[model samples]
Target: MRLLELTLPDAVENVALDEALLRQVEETDGQPVLRLWELESYAVIVGRANRIERNVNVEACRRDGVPIVRRFSGGGTVLLGPGALVFSLFLRVEKDRHLANIDAATAIVLDRVLTPLKGLVASLERKGTSDLASEGVKVSGNSQRWLRSTFLHHGTLLYDFDVSLIERYLSDPEREPDYRQGREHADFVRNLPISRDELRKSLTEAWDARLDPPELPFDLVRDLVRDRYRNDEWTFRM
Candidate 1:
């Protein structure tokens, strides 16, 4: 697999690049890719179909000058800031047949990727469809999007994140796993007691990925940002 460890200066671009990589690979039938990135500032990423008014505190984010954007995948909304590590994996469904089914793919992929993290966070286990939890609180969350032959599995690893920010921006998710038990964000989520480097190492080791910077699809990423991610119509359409 190829490795890309970069954070685009713009949050929209970072989100766009995740889809760009998946598209680029599907177009070329290329190898799998592992991308690691972190945002230095706070941002709100809603699922493709999520309604901001229902899921996020739009006025609070606007007053604070934070960008509220939508990603190309379907999952719960998440608050991202400095201390969060984002890892995206692009895989060919033809090569990995496990990815052909959404539920099984999420479980198989997460279990494989999170094996090395057992040492980093004791008692870490997957709680719902795509959450990695420790003890009794949430630590990591994941979501997905797939194309004709390739799929994108990306998620966040909260190492030193401020869990309080979640409640400040996002409301309680409308679609909750039974395990959540109606607990609010602050009480339900917690950061992993680990460093970004440690998390990155564990993921890289799990994927057996090499740090090879392949030819990036910069034009596609820019186009996607301008056409989708940065467009307010696309963000609030739902």
Candidate 2:
């Protein structure tokens, strides 16, 4: 897999780029990609099917000038900022048989992630469906999106996040894994006990992914935002 380390200035553009990259992979039928990026600022990203009002504190977000946008994948809402590292994997469905089913797909990808995570922190386990937790507190959360020939498996690794921000801007998620056990965000989530470089290096080596440039239809990202992600009509359409 090829690796691309790129993040846009605008938070919505980063979300749109997630869809754009997956579509680009389908168009090229190229190598699987592992794109790692960090948001320069703060944003509240809602899952494709999530109810924004239920998952996010809209008044708090607006008061703090945080952009609330929706992505193309189904999962709970997430808060993205400089402290978080986002990894996006674009893979060909035919390349991996596990990609054909949703549960298996999530399993295989996260199982691969556990290799490096275990090395970084002890007693770390794959809890629930797509979360990496240590001693029952989540450090990473993931979600997926599929197309005809390719799919996207992306998630946030809380390498150095501020947990308080989540309490301020996000309401209690409507959907959660059983392991969460109705705990508040502050109690349920924690940052990984690893530096960004260490975590990035481990993931890159685990996947055998080499760093690459931004070669995949950059124009499509802007178009995606213009047509869908950046528009409040589409973002809040539910």
Task: Report, for every candidate in turn, its global Cα lDDT versus the true structure.
Answer: 0.90, 0.89
For residues 84-149, could you state the per-residue lDDT of candidate 1 as single tens digits? 999999988988776768898999889987799997777899998899888878888999998988
Give the poorly placed runs of model 1, Cα more than 4 Å off: none
lDDT at position 210, candidate 1: 98
Q: TM-score per candidate, in order?
A: 0.98, 0.97
- lDDT for each residue of candidate 2 in 110-212, tens digit (9 for 90 to 100): 8888887787787888899888899999998899998998989999888889988999999999888999999999999999888999889988987899977
RMSD of every candidate to native, in Å, equals: 0.9, 1.0
RMSD in Å for model 2: 1.0
Error of 2 at 156 (Å): 0.8
